[model samples]
Target chain A: AQSVTQPDIHITVSEGASLELRCNYSYGATPYLFWYVQSPGQGLQLLLKYFSGDTLVQGIKGFEAEFKRSQSSFNLRKPSVHWSDAAEYFCAVAANSGYALNFGKGTSLLVTP
Target chain B: DVKVTQSSRYLVKRTREKVFLECVQDMDHENMFWYRQDPGLGLRLIYFSYDVKMKEKGDIPEGYSVSREKKERFSLILESASTNQTSMYLCASRRQGTTNEKLFFGSGTQLSVL
Candidate 1:
């Protein structure tokens, strides 16, 4: 079965500091990887996605993710963290022909000023 | 812009009552999905519709059913609402084609079964 794993349950980062959220996936073949962020009481918004080429994909809100095939990972990174960046982040994977996405447990990021 | 709209932002109901959650999309997407969001569990798929009148069970679909009578409308129904059914229900839509496309989500409906 395909699965996504977000190791960190909660992470605290100071504002203006760099941040990295780790994600690992288990799939049979090359998968469609995605990172989604959700604010309090709001639906999820797509952060970035990795499908075919370009291991490094930049998404909205100045976020980027690197898809590492060998490690089966797609980690999200930000050079500078803002106070508004505090939210729940989820890593998801879908098979090439699959319709539904398999999401991880999610990581809650808390930004301190 | 693609807009997926959920009927309600918040709802409260009594246990054993029948519940209905409606979703509509303006993008004319062929795929619509329902998911329940919880604190630690993340987002769990409840049901998805590929086309009109075509519904498929997702990861967690036991207490829910779906109806897609039109291309832009997808309705999620709970036969008998229970306290455990209280959750944040999200509606999403995506165009048909490859799996690489991102899904457009609604603001979500927070349902409380008391």
Candidate 2:
């Protein structure tokens, strides 16, 4: 079974500061990776996805993630974060053939002024 | 934009009551999923339907059943509601035949079983 691990349970950053959320996966082969964000009382929204091609993928809301095969990691990063960026972030992994996604426990991002 | 609409934004039910949560998709997607979200637990899949009349069990299926009589609608049922079942329920849909497609989600229904 493919699984995703997000080490940080909570992260806080000041407005305009750079942000990075760590994600690691355990899969036998190269897996499909995704980053999702959820605001309070809202459903999950896709931040970005990585299937094939370049390791780095850009997503909506000025967010990006890099798939590092050697580290079994697909970490989400942003050059600068705004207050709206404060939300719960999840990392998910799926097998090449499976349709279901395995999600992490999530990391709560807090932005301060 | 794809929209997956869940019938209710909030629901309250008593123990042993029958509960049904309805989900409908507007994009004519072939795949629909039901998941439950709790604090510190992320989202756990409860059930998924790949096609009309075709359903699959996800990570957690206990005390839950689903119906997919029509392609655009999928319903989740709780035969006997329990306090443990209280959580935020989310419905999502995505097109089949693609490995990289992202899921479109509903705003979610927060269910409280007392």
Candidate 3:
């Protein structure tokens, strides 16, 4: 079974500040990694996903995540964040042939001006 | 754009009452899923359907059932609604035959069981 772990339950970053949200997964073999964001009163939206090949994957809203196979980590990072980037982020992991995704507890991002 | 439409945005039901949550997808997706979201829990899968009349129990399937008589529509049923079942229900769909699994989600239906 693949599981995702997000160490930070809540994170606060100032506007124009660099942001990094850490994510770790537990799987014996290579797993599929994904990052999703959910705004207030909105549904979950896909940010980026890493299946294979490139270790660094780019997503919408200037977000990117790097997949480190050796460390079993897929951390999301942004050079600069905006106030509108305040939302809850989730990290999910699924097996290569799995049908369901196991999501983390989520990290609530608060962007302070 | 892929669209997954859940019938209700919000619903209030009484304990022991029978409840149904409907979901439909516009894109002819082969897989559809039902999930419940809580404060700490990001999302817990309840049920999923791979094809019409084919269903699979997800991580948390107790106290809930699902019906998929058609390919585009998947229905979640709670035989006896309970307060613990009160949460945001989300429906998602994704095309099969690929490992991408980029799910298209509905707006979600907030069900409050009293």
Candidate 4:
């Protein structure tokens, strides 16, 4: 079974500051990686995903993630974050070509004005 | 745009009561999934259906069952609601035969079993 580990449970940053949420996965082989965001009282939305090709993947809302095979990580990064970006972020993986996705516990992001 | 709609936004059920969670997709997706989200637990897949009348158990299917009698609708049933089942239930749908496709999710139903 593949599992995603998000070391940070919660993170706070000032608006316009750079942000990075760490994510690590445990899988024997390359797996489908994804980053999802959930706003208050809303469903989870896809931010980005990485399957193959370039190691660096760009996503919506000025966010990006790099799939580092050596480090077993797919860390999401944003050079500057907006107050609207304050939400719960999750890292998910679909292993063994399965449709079922395994998600991390999630990291709650807080942005200060 | 694809839209997944769950029947309820919030539900309150008593213990030992039978519960049904309905999900419908506007798009003719071939796959639908049921998941439960708990604080500090993210989301756990309960069941998924690939086609009408085809259902598969996901990671946490021990306490839940699913029905897919129609292509665009999938239903999750809790035989006996328990306090432990209190959580946000989410429904998602995806196009079949595509690995790169993302799942379209509903707003989710916050179910509370008392």
Candidate 1's TM-score reads 0.96
lDDT (Cα, tens digit) per residue for candidate 4, span A2-102: 99999999999999999999999999899999999999877789999998899999999999999999999999999999999999999999884546788
- Models 1 onward score TM values of 0.96, 0.97, 0.97, 0.97
Error of 3 at A56 (Å): 0.8
Q: Please state the error at residue A80 of candidate 2 in Å.
A: 1.3
Residues A1-113 of candidate 3: C-alpha lDDT, one tens digit per residue:
78999999999999999999999999988898999999999889999999889899999999999999899999999999999999999998878753777789899999999
Tens digits of per-residue lDDT for model 2 on B1-114?
768999999999999999999999999988899999999999899999888999999999999999999999999999999999999999988888555879889999999999
> In candidate 1, which residue ranges exceed 4 Å CA deviation?
none
Q: Could you give the interface RMSD of each candidate, to one decimal? A: 1.4, 1.4, 1.6, 1.5
Give the proportion of true interface contacts each model preserves, from 0 to 1: 0.64, 0.60, 0.49, 0.57
- Over B1-104, each residue of candidate 1 has an lDDT whose tens digit, in order, gives 77999999999999999999999999988988999988899999999988899999989999899999999999999999999999999998888875798889
Chain A TM-scores in order: 0.97, 0.97, 0.98, 0.98
Candidate 2 DockQ vs. native: 0.69
Q: Which run of 10 residues does model 1 chain B get worst, by summed lDDT?
A: B94-103
DockQ of 4: 0.67
lDDT of 4 by residue, B6-42 (tens): 9999999999999999999989988889989999999
| Cα distance off (Å), candidate 1, residue A8 | 0.8
